[model samples]
Target: MTTEFSPRLFERDSEIRALGEGLLACALPREAWTHEAHLGACLWLLSERPDIDVDAEIGGIIRRFNESVGGVNDDTQGYHDSITRAYVAGVRLFLSETTATSLVERVNAMLLSDVGRRDWPLRFYSRELLFSVPARRGFVEPDRMPLPVAHK
Candidate 1:
């Protein structure tokens, strides 16, 4: 099977990662799916559409600014080289750009949407894929803590 590589696909990968990281920052489970699983989900989305060419498919929506910028990451190669790891990095890029609340809402919408539930292979999507990603995102600070006692 030929894997199509295009600027758009990389862009989408970046978008998805951004969305995921943003949602995760607010309240995504610390351990739900593995890093590989996240990548698998995206891969399935790209390949699942038979009409669309996996390589040609745009992984994300293209933006006006990006057109002139060219090349999402300087060091990272195209999607074919490191699919999972690249996707993971996209997540961080996304987190930096957006807020957590909207991210959660978007994720919920995607999860509930029809496209999200359609059957896809689970081998990579399963918990095993977790290893592909980091356990904690630098300084696992608690979301909240009890209020400090008032001074007398």
Candidate 2:
């Protein structure tokens, strides 16, 4: 019997790693507008990882964020509200015909520019949500990039 090598395996792993790197890159300080962009990139990555339950994870993040803040009264609560909006936008983008490549590039530019560094917590969580897709798919390597710092 002859052994045949399947290139698909390598291709899939490469794709997963690329997505993981994108998520890591998005883990930067951000402003309110960047939230939707970050989530958009996340949706793109999640779409590529069918094994991960995107809806459930998004729902849990929203629920936990809401429960943690209770209501959108203060700045912190307002930040969570923006994250909710971003999440909604992400879902919309994921279902629509928009291209993920363009959106990812836009997100990268915005994050690198540090347009909104004040809202680091929201940005961190957004990236965390994105990272979860690869993590769930078993693509995350602790040594590759440090996990997002926990927001108090």
Q: Best by TM-score, which number? A: 2
Measured against the true structure, the TM-scores of the candidates, in listed sequence, are: 0.21, 0.29
lDDT score for candidate 2 against the true structure = 0.39
lDDT of 1 at 97: 37
Candidate 2 per-residue C-alpha lDDT over 8-82 given as tens digits, one digit per residue, 9 for 90 to 100:
111233433454344444332233223443343454445555765654554444333434434332332322333
Worst 10 residues of 2 by lDDT: 3-12
RMSD for all candidates, in order, please: 19.3, 17.7
- Candidate 1 wrong stretches, greater than 4 Å: 1-81, 106-152
Positional deviation of residue 142's Cα in model 1 after best superposition, in angstroms = 35
